[model samples]
Target: MIAAPLREKKRYGWFDAALRALLEETDAALEAGVDVPEEPGGWWHQYVCPTHGTELRFDPREREATAFRCPHGCVLEGEAYRGAWLVFKHQERARTALSAAAMYAATGEAKYAEAANAILEAYASRYPRYPVHPDAQPWMLKGRAFHQALTEAIWATTILRAFLLLRDEGALQVDAAASDVFFAMVSSSMTEYRRILIEERDEPANNYTAWLNACLACYYAVRDDRDGMETLVSARGGLRHHLEIGVLPDQLEFEGSLYYHVFVLRAYFIAAEMAERLGFDATAWTGSAGQSFRGMLEALVGLAAPNGELPALHDGPYSRPPYAREIAEVFEIGYARYGDARFAPILREAYRRADGGCGGGTGSAERRGLEAVLYGEGDWPAAEPLREPSRLYASAGFAVLRHADNPLSLLADFGPHGGSHGHDDKLNVVLMHRNGFVLPERGMVPYGSELRRRWFARTPSHNAVSVGGRTQAPHTGVCLRFDAEARRSYAWLRSEGAYAGATLDRHLWVDRDVALDWFEVRLDLEETVDYWLHFAEPLNVGGGWTACTPDAAPGEDEAYGYVATSARWTAEEPFAAVAATCGGERVTASLLAVPGGELYRIASPGTSVDPSRPLDGLLYRARGRRATFVAAFAAGDAPIRLARGDEGSVLVAPAGGGGTAMRFRMTEHGLHRE
Candidate 1:
């Protein structure tokens, strides 16, 4: 069993051809290369910003490498971008170590082996002296290997993988003392990494937590530490213990961020690959939803937009996040083990559609040179996922409704307003029409931008109800019912803790006609309740809710709320209803007022008078004990109409009325019609 890694390598000998090709491409000509990289010990060597003509240098000999400054005036404005640079620095070293190992295997070049050994030695000697980051969360973690244990884990996983390669292949030639020192450096730092994982054991496995576990599993396997490797098994109650519990039953990560989903899934695949090499048994694990390996991949397929990009739910990319790219190449290892035809084709197609032409962009920590070498050659068979859409993560309280023909997906959020990465979008509704948004979540913004607070975390961006004009409280969302049928299906979600005494329930029925999309939202408030309908850029607006439209800028500066002298819907003025057309779809929204008429407050089409402002959603509001809004939206040239029954049921009719209509029966308990 100890020789399992050798057997595994021998099994994949076809990959050696690819590795040799990459070696020649890089000219791994040991005949002429001798000088080590000038700066070899610390993070990055030196970087110059092309935009500002500024430079930031790192000296491996200096203890205060983090205290360096920007010369020629290129001060980075945000730390997220800065953090990416730091990760990149580690990535460069990892790529180097991997390249050297692969090159040595292909060419039997002594220089390649020596170069890889020198870098590892440098890391081993300097690894212990690095101080723990002061601002790391959880308070107990102290990263002596790097500024944060997360970064330290990345560094360890990288060099250690190379170490295993060299040691197993007989490329490593070192004295006994040198070997002992290298082993000691790794043992000490890895202990700190393990401590962080043990401390945060009970929390859900977010990206970093999952990463730490997977990396350590690989570490123990490489070191041949039997007791340590056992710590990762489910029987021992370890981090990788139970896949069923950590990943929600729907197979989506709890955070709901596509990038994080990719981050964590990548960690699992990498670890599983390493475990296989070292003769570990983790490759066969499966979760309740499906297996975390294949099941989660299908879940991601369901959550994706028609174009294959996922919505940036939490701390995901501002534009559609690219975590799916992480799946294709990393999934190669999993496909070999499962041989599930369903997974390979879906993964390959997604990889084919990648904007980068593969999984990662150049110069990203996600891109490993060896990954390119190990990926399959041109003989991949074409395949597609054997699954359909609108998967529900019941345990996490979320659901998505999708139709392959319509390319329109409705994502309903009722899950944990997850952690810090989560937005305050419990029971929020996001409608996806191909690449366009009917109602969108506050997409991410640069962390340091003004829009970050104004758009990312606030209530106005989400399609939610504000009771008494206050945002909902921090409550996990609940999905009461979800049925995905051709035309008769509907979605229902409830938010009990969004307010102190108020409860908001939303139900949406998707008519197969694509022109009779109807919904009814009920807000039970103790004091005042204002139901909001935030639409994307509207093509046309015809309604009674336009009276609150501001004529100028300061009037719509978010501070001033317009008070109409005479209300239109409830008014002394006249009675009218709200209607709109967006991206060729017509939407009509109306509230089920008990006996009185509906009162509303709507922003002007150019409310801010600045067409540049992203705040274009309309707000139709009312103050009462209980208010229910019945609305319908559809895609086509016809206007959708609604009629309410005396018994409190509502009927929605689309143009061309070809026996395709939807109804909603309002009741004291809840909705009875669909």
Candidate 2:
């Protein structure tokens, strides 16, 4: 039997610090006690503030309170909110049981063991009686304790870890008969979980499958069932198959969402750690194409922004406080497993930005968590600052161009359409400064929100061109050329199927101070196309703009209907400028003239859930079978001039005509800059 590491005392300062933190949390849990709701939980996503369209707040400490409150002054009571409270209770019970079990192993405290046993026994007794969630979709695998099998898998994995720790410490030896009963019930539920995952939701290349596999691996390891383990590894949609197919060649999770990427990584990491404890070679396992967990870690490290947060591409939250803390814990585990030095900067930054700390020590060591206590090294790695260069992940379909000293960076998405969770915004781009996003992707909203389909997931929410006011069709984009130099980086991408019988091409050039964008579209039939740019901060458009509503508000049936305010401009000059202030820094964009193009300034919902908060946007519309547009963007007071050049080329130069001029042209080969 594998002995729990926390059972033995260690002389490491980091370990002690992390242990102190865990014990504090465990003490709090013990005081609060466990509350197992008699009714099963509903979909957590449904617990949204109906008025504000944001998640409702529930105080875990107030276990009996049923009226959920939103961050705004809205209060909601009833089935969905109450059911969501039950979900919270179930989650807290599982987490508290784990903390208690760890404390019992570390300190041999009977009180901790009793607390853990009480929660586990309560769950075991009630597991068979809870009905499958009523709100679950017909195609989805339902759960007894939670709404979906995915969430049930997550709960079971945590609970089993607690159970295994207690079992290994011989805490359960006192009453073997009761322990046996608990194991039989929980293990039977796990078997049903495995059956549903394998027989019903047979998605080999999905994050859901990874969680299902983790739960099954934990169960088999606890039972010491070698045959079951082997079967899980060898089955068609099992662990090995998921690992091989779900992780793309570029090492990103196939979903193309940074949040889901980390989510899937956490599940696999847990499974690998459990397998290693069972004396298996799972940690050393490699996929068919030689992909390994180490490669995936490297991919994450490569994708970290200068602030160490991953971009909220596709369907994920922007890396902020609580989420950043969770990401730090994941990085701590990765550093322990691989000893990679690149993770140090991200770990340090994440901890520094985390909302609260354990008050244990200064610097990175201050914010240690359970992972750090269990697996971290004694001496913390130096938090060396990163000076990343512009690069492209061809397989993953992302190109990042970083300006010197990290003042400006642009991420261009030109790869495969992320399955299901992907936004229909091909050739979408997100621009950022050292502080935050300039043109941001609204990432995603809760799955239960109508706005998720009506606005956030649509093409208008991103920085891309929409044809016929319709979202782009699901399609992969191809990078035509990518080049990085000492002062400039350039990329050209093409998508043929974003619209049927049409071709879309984009050229992006980033210099030390300015970015030039050229977008071209050719359709077999005449159609109206609109180029969109959304700003995180409010924007001011200049050059004789007048308030006016168009024939329709852009797209009445589409995401454009969310536009609450509008203004129009028919430029007298060949160029128009729009500017925004971010963190007291002025950023400006200069648009080159399009023949007969109509420019509109609009305000739309700023975030996925909050419609009351508005974001500024610029929409340039043209009606034709073919269209081309050029624009230049820069920080501060740089005057940028964009104009048509000789031989189908575009010219970007200083407005006063003194600075170095750059000429760009698209050829049959690729984009060329001179």
Candidate 3:
């Protein structure tokens, strides 16, 4: 039986030569991008210009140029060159070399072999001299060619693959010294990364830790460092710690970002796959928390929408369907390794996404080449995509309520707002109907931007409870209960730290029986607070009072946060409820009478919006303390009706037999469930 690349004899290693041949034919081989003219020709690179960490395409019409320029005529300025783009270029050179070597192997062509040897020799000669990127972090390995350890580790895996590809083709045989130097560079990189990773073994880990372990695993395999592999495999709180803290029990990425989750998963997947390829057992290695590598991928497949988009949560932007070409190679490879029949249908969906250029690679020959072999796209028949069930991520403190039949879904975030990438939106709620937002979460801006600091990440920008005219305080949440039983889904999250002296309990109840969904927020406060509900657009109507949604309201400043810019209750609310057209949807909300309860139409606080533009928002001021606000909203154009009871509770019924009449009462003592 043919051994994996790492186990093969280095002296005569054309590892996976058949795959290389396929890649060469399709220009997806490691050396596929390398160009050699049939006749000696002038440098083709003369027509191209590189700038701003991006490549500019020339018109190719101009024969001669003073300096290379893109069609936009922009001169390229070199930034610190330690990014993924630069790393991709380096890999391009390596792949090009490997492709040429593969051609020589197949056809015994001397020129191809020489071309391949030249690339390896050039890199090996200069390998020791390429300085650490000026922008590299202090902890980054000084002599490593890549700026980031993660990038360096990735380079190690790909470069080694390139080396193995050409070893059997007599290229490495012709120059034993260069071959030793090339592997020496690999050894140096592995040693540095392993040292740094082990040094910081106890730090609260992130995706970086997962990647570090992956790199170490791959390195151990290549170097035949069994002891090193054992050290890593047995390292306490190393990869195990990352899994324990970073991934929830149900396989949710604890950081709450789909992008980062995928990023971390891919690295671990590569490592585990590499380990198995080297005849090691790593897949079943669960973390300290009993979390296995397989569990992460198991739950990830359902996250994609019907069109293959991972739902945008945390830092990932809301992508429309076919989200960036969903890559299913992980699943594809998973199926191959585990021989699990379930992955076949999902694999088909992933292949469909790859065909759309989101995954598998449209322009990358290396990625496309491997994908063709690894994915086995057509080997599996297509099946219906799996729909993610309504789940409450209790450990991570995120609650999602998705309906059985409709696209109406609500994401309630009570989780740790994740460090750096986190928002101050504790107990915040985002609702979607038919994939269109009924209540939208604040759109994300660039990380660490001034606007992000001041507004976008603030609690006021979210659908949350504000107390004492300040944002919600930092807090951890306990999901008291989560049940998706028969007709409805019920979840209650209690947060004691939301306010310094108050306890906040938010309940999301979805009753599919009556086709109604609503939120019940009860704050046991020591001080008076305000409930801020920001809508996507201006409202057109208010029951028991006049609703204002002018093109531009006078005296009201535009705001991105829910903080009131300028708001006044025009007249005493002698009526029980208010109804209005909230942006694209309709909403009718009535307060359960409290001693100090008062309601008014307000505007969202944002620096970006013009004051002349209408900002649709709602504010309910709980006069004294201990305020309970009950709000019911239907996703689409469902109007509402409210009738106040004789005592204080308001009976809420939608225009068409509102599913359930939810009652919430607030007294000086506390909230009373009616």
Model 2 pairs in collision: none
Per-residue lDDT over 204-303 for candidate 2, one digit per residue giving the tens place of the 0 to 100 score: 5767778888888888887887787787777766767777888887888887888888888878877776776666787657787766788887777666
Candidate 1 per-residue lDDT, tens place, 437-497, comes to 5665545543333444444455545666666655556678677777877655567777778
lDDT of residue 451 for candidate 1:
40
* Candidate 3 segments whose C-alpha is farther than 4 A from its true place: 1-126, 137-143, 161-183, 224-227, 237-246, 253-256, 301-308, 316-327, 335-373, 377-385, 432-452, 468-470, 513-626, 633-674
| Model 3 residue 341 distance off true place after TM-score fit, in angstroms | 8.0
| Order of candidate numbers by TM-score, starting with the best | 2, 1, 3
Q: Write the per-residue lDDT of candidate 3 for residues 326-392, one digit (tens) a residue.
A: 3454665565456655555444444443443321123221223334343332234344434456777
How does candidate 1 fare on TM-score?
0.71
Comparing 2 and 3 by lDDT, which wins? 2
| Model 3 residue 670 lDDT score | 36
How high is each candidate's TM-score? 0.71, 0.89, 0.67
Tell me the deviation in Å of residue 113 in model 3: 10
Worst 10 residues of 2 by lDDT: 356-365
| Cα RMSD, each candidate | 7.8, 3.9, 9.1
Clashes of 3: 17
